[model samples]
Every structure is written in C-alpha cells, then in structure tokens.
Target: MNVEAPWRGNNLARQIVVLSALSFMIIAAVIGAGAFGNTAVEDQQDGALSTNGSYLAPAGPAFSIWSVIYLGLIAYAIWQALPRQRTNRRQRALGWLIALTMTLNGLWLVTARFGTLFLTVVVIVLLLAALGWTFRVAVRTREPRGGVVDSILIDGVTGLHLGWVTLATVANTAAWLTTIAPASWEKAADAIGIGVLVVVGLIGLAIAWQSSWRLTPALALAWGLSWLAVERFGGEPRSTGIGVMAIIVAAFVLLPPAVIRILRLLRPSVD
Candidate 1:
C-alpha cells in the first residue's frame, strides 16, 4: 500500500471523534457494572494475591497490564487515523482491528467483573486472536530495512496480549471447574492449568525465536516469571514448583537468542 499523504484530505479528526466516543461508551459500561468496588470479584482476587494473602494466582497483576496495552493501542489508533497514515493500508487495518479488540476488551471486563467467567474467557480468546492477526499484518507492511523496530513494537503488544490471555483462559476455566464441580476437582484443575501454562510458554518461546521477536519475548518472559514468583511465594502452595520450573525452562529457551542478538549489535564490524 502507498504511504498516505499527510494533512491533505486526512479524516483524522473524524476518526478521533468516533474512537473517543466509543471509548467513553466502553468506560461508562464498565463503570455501570459496579466493577470499581473494592470487593468486586476481580478486586477480591487481586487482593487475594497481595503480599498478605495466601492465594498465588497470577491473573490479577497480569490483567493490570491491560491498561498499558490499551494505551498503546489507543495511541496507535490515533496515529493511524492521522492524515499521513490514513491511506496506509496496514495502518488502517491495524486501527480497525484495535478498535474491535478494544470493544471486546470492554465486554470481557464487564463479563469478568460480573463473575461470568465462561463468557469472559470467550471474549478474551477472541481478543487475543484478533491481536495476533493485527500483529501479522502490521509486520508484513513494514519496509524491509527499518521495519524491524516497528514490527517489534507491534508484535510485542500482540505477544503480550496473547500470552496473558492464554493464562487467563486457563484460570477462568479453573474457576468454572471449581465453582461447578466437586471440591475434589481442584487438584485436577490446578494440574491442567500448570500443564497448559507450560505448553503456552513453549509456544511463546517458539514464536519469539522464529520471528526473532526480541523485545516481545522479554515482556512475555517477565510476565511469566512474575506470575511464577507470585505463585511460589504467595501461599497457594499448589503447583508453585511447577510454575517456577516452567518459567525457568522458558527463560533458558527465550533469553539466549535475544542476548546473542544484543551481543552482535554491540560488536564492532571487522571490515
């Protein structure tokens, strides 16, 4: 796609108006759900993971990253809608996808807040899928030479969203199992959650290596490590060892390549 002309015939103002309006609507819906209460289901879970609490679930802090992700997305949307980028096919597509994902994000917040775990999981799953698609398209649109930096930013956001939601989905499924099934099922649910996390971490490592997605893997690994640490020390006592081990394995796989890349950058050309 051709690079869009700047200022001339740009409809950025209209785009911003629409997006701002949509954002307001989403915020209003979230507020109306009484999701702000201290003891709201999500907040209670967060508190449960606090230093004084005994539970070790990772969903609480991981979800807080959504605020940062959303801000990045909103900025990207506005940038794309700017007169200079409006005609850029990749930018336009990314903007639209971000808007859709943001809408779904709001819905997920509302559902999760109301304790509708299943529906919340479904929404987050879709949002992650959308983010993956957008990242791919954005990377494909980059100029061959300098595009890596842009791709890194886009892919970083996408990978982080994917990684976190994959964990959230597992957590949500466990919540459902614990709520609906016999107490005896808790062990099975925890087992399944840890297993899924391991596989997800492996997949994340594979993507990071294959794409040489350096910065993305760092964020993802940090997220995985923090969660594992939380589980290990936060007192849930169930599968904490497994979670920590998974982080270790993921770090061994994901970090070495990034370090190599950095080393190469620092080395002077022999010429």
Candidate 2:
C-alpha cells in the first residue's frame, strides 16, 4: 500500500489547508479569549458554562489547559506551513483534517457564545468527532515522519485536544441535561456524576491501551479529572462521594501509561 497515495501531488492543497488551519486557530483564540464582544464560556448562557454548571464540571483552573492547547495549535499551524513541510507526506495526510478540527473548534466557541446550550453541545460533539478522526489518522500513520518535533506539535497536540474535549463533552452534555431534566432529578446528581466519571475512566483506559500508552492524552485527562475532584471536594455542589470517585478515575486513567513509562526506563531494551 502506498502511504502517500491519498496525498500524492497535493502540495497546493496541503498549503491551503495549513494556512486555513492557522487562520482558524487565530479566530478561535480570539473568540475564546472574549474578543469582539464574545463573552467567556462560563459567563455565557447564564453561567451554564461555569464550574458549578454541572456536577461533572471541573474546577475553574482546569480550563487553563486551553492556554497550552491554543499555543500548541498555533505552533502546529506555523510548523506545518514551513516551506520544507509543504510537501511532507505526513502533513499532506493530516493537514486537511487538522484544518477541519480547527474550524470546528472555532465553530464550537461561536455556538457556545451566541447559540443555545443544545447547539453548543451539538457543535462540541462535532468537534470531538473531528478530533477523533484526526487521532485515528495519527495512529494509522504510526511512526512520526518528521521526528520528535513533529510528534510533539502534531501527535501530542492532537492527543491533548481529543482528551480534553472528550471530558468536556461529558460535562457539556450534563449541563444541557440540567436544563431539560426534571427538577427532582437534582437529588440523583451525585450518582449520575459518579457513573459518568466511571465511563470517562473506562474511555481513558481504552485510549491509553489503543494508543500504545500515549501519555499526552493521559496528562490532559488526569488534569481535568483532578480539577473535577477539587471542585467537588471544595466548591459548590460539593459531594465527597463524587470527589473520591473522581480521584479514583484520575488514578486509573493515569496509572497504565505511567507504569509503562517507568518499566521502559528500568528496562531500556523492552520496546
């Protein structure tokens, strides 16, 4: 199978996609940072995006990961647009999908700011799907073509994006549910939150195994889960049960890849 068949002779197309991705990244950063009358995500929709917006919502500081993600994305955009990278097969295979992810991210923020929670959820799910597709392609491409720097800017950033958005989808859906669910359901929030956390844990473990114990996604997942534990333990909608479950889920998601890395360090010839 010719790995380059799909992207053969697509240099112009690749360049276009890379430029569009960079443009979309800039737009998303602007919208996300509250530029041009765009309110913060938490401040929009009557605070439905806040930390207390849902039982599954992480703590306030958990969102700081956006800074890292956005920066990584910008770096990826610039890196992929370089003259030498313009004809790279790996970039050709990935550029269009990455552009789609960037576009979807900007669309999600726009929907969240100006549209309904339901619409925001819809856009986020789409964004997640785009990221998931990107992840699949990265896995299929397997060996990093452009070496360590390429692995970080492309694979690493994509993993972080996918992982964070995976958890965010859960929280976003929970927030949307709050609007439509019966008021009496409030009493069951803790149980529901725990169940969702368990599902998240399972998904994280699956990703870890499937990606050969990739650590970037695990880092993002654990970061988000840790903050959820912090919020539940100390913030409004406090629930010790949920907090403990969150910590447990975080640990489970992190342990597999972490242990793998430790073993590799101890036995350098294992891989």
RMSDs, each prediction? 5.3, 3.0
Q: Write the per-residue lDDT of candidate 2 for residues 5-59, one digit (tens) a residue.
A: 6654577677777678668667866876787887877888888888999888999
- Give the distance in Å from residue 247's predicted Cα in candidate 1 to where it truly belongs: 2.8
Best candidate (score: lDDT): 2
Q: List model 1 lDDT by residue over 1-271, tens digit each.
A: 5554453334464466438645854584456335565244444333322322322246346556766665655555555555655555454446556566666667666665554655655776787677666655654555332255345445556666655565555455554544457767555644665566566667666655555554554465557556655665553545665556556655754576567667768874511
Candidate 2 off by > 4 Å: 1-9, 142-144
Candidate-wise lDDT, in order: 0.55, 0.86
Q: How many backbone clashes does every candidate have?
A: 0, 0
Deviation of model 1 at 208, angstroms: 1.4
In TM-score terms, which candidate is top? 2
Give the range where candidate 1 is weakest over 10 consecutive residues by summed lDDT.
47-56
